[model samples]
Target: MIEHATHQKIALITGANKGIGRAAAEQLAALGMTVLIGARDPRRGEEAAAALRAAGGNAHQVTLDVTDQATARAAAQQIDERFGHLDVLINNAGITGSGQVSPEDAHDQVPSSVNLDMVRAVFETNVFGVIAVTNAMLPLLRRSPAPRIVNVSSAAGSLTIASDPDGPLTGLPTSAAYTPSKTALNALTVQYANELRKNGFLVNAADPGYVDTEINNHSGYLTVAQGAAALVRLATLGADGPTGGFFSEDGPVPW
Candidate 1:
């Protein structure tokens, strides 16, 4: 087996100021990889990095706002200068546009009544942002001997589960905006993985299983650490690990 850090693998995790992203950063840092906590908020990013360092993890802050092309380029350039190569890229930053926009609103805020502008807003960050950040960082990632990219997706994005009236996801009706954005992300993951595989890069989508975080108002049963388990696992896969796959903690998730 290849030593986890012999090649000094460096990982960049977006929206890592808190929640599952933060947890993944800690786990990766514990394994000897230098973990970059990519945050839109610099202060929060620094605080998270400080907390991780205090906990004995090799962590640092990277000011990353996936929606902004300039920030994405700067971050990629910064990583290239410091680490020379990026071994893992975790697109963990995401938002539930409706929830963030109107907390008091009911689940009916989505579906037929979902504001199209809100849906577009979420897509800007969730879909287009991922593409921008990934493309900007692809150069450094390509330099890695075994590069890995993990898109933090959700079970809500599964068209199979979403369309299945008998499935568990049928309970959630408010999916027009946040959910479809993730569906697009899943599609993007497959295409990127197919294109990057010949270059020894493994790109896959990870379903964290609805962990309790600010996004869900702490109603989820799983903790952030538990939610991050699947992401961390997929992020650390070896050269021979599966690619172009969408997985959860239990195993593969349907498209």
Candidate 2:
């Protein structure tokens, strides 16, 4: 295996070619971590890595498609060959199940009339994909001195918030796809944290509040940097940081 600096932290972020994932990579890279930009498209991934390098950050590209286990395994093998171990994992790939439609026009996602196929697709990427990637990389992560896993979740996944009568999402249309997938992801995050805690792993879910990205067709009010803050914070948390919990920029998010 190729050797890297033993003291330097290495991070892999899926869907890091743009949006919140890329922003989180930028922050991590700025903090002196070698960031790996994981994208389904090789060209896009290379472009993003090159951009980060140009900006004076250590970056690399890894072809990753969370929905495909073959690609996940290949990514793991590649990382093992190059870095020998992985210090951080940011499972950030996700979908809104609305296609190219705007949030306000996502009537098709209404629980009563939502497409089962769309829901499955969303879960394939957001929930199951995380499991695939995490399991594949667990061996490499195990080699790190302080392994950290951060699952990029959303506030919509908070059942307590959605159920509140006067909550911020009170007026939003009922969702049956994207939102539920994130809820499942949140649960999965906690399970992983519980299972890996004895190994000194800091695993947590981050609720990146609404950000202007392709997921919502730029309808969100927050910037990408703002959306990525919670993720970066959790990935670099101290050993005393909370595990098996959901948090946002403000503080803990009710699950």
- Tell me, by TM-score, which candidate is best: 2
In angstroms, the error of model 2 at 98 is: 1.0
Kindly list the per-residue Cα lDDT of model 1 for residues 56-134, writing each as its tens digit. 9888899999989999999998887777788899999998885545655434446777766677778999999999999
Instruction: Give the top-scoring candidate (lDDT).
Output: 2
Model 1 misplaced regions, further than 4 Å: 1-6, 99-109
What global local distance difference test value does model 2 have? 0.94
Tens-digit lDDT track of model 2 for 92-142: 999888762445445577888777878888899999999999999999999
* TM-scores of all predicted structures: 0.94, 0.96
Cα lDDT of all candidates, in order? Answer: 0.90, 0.94
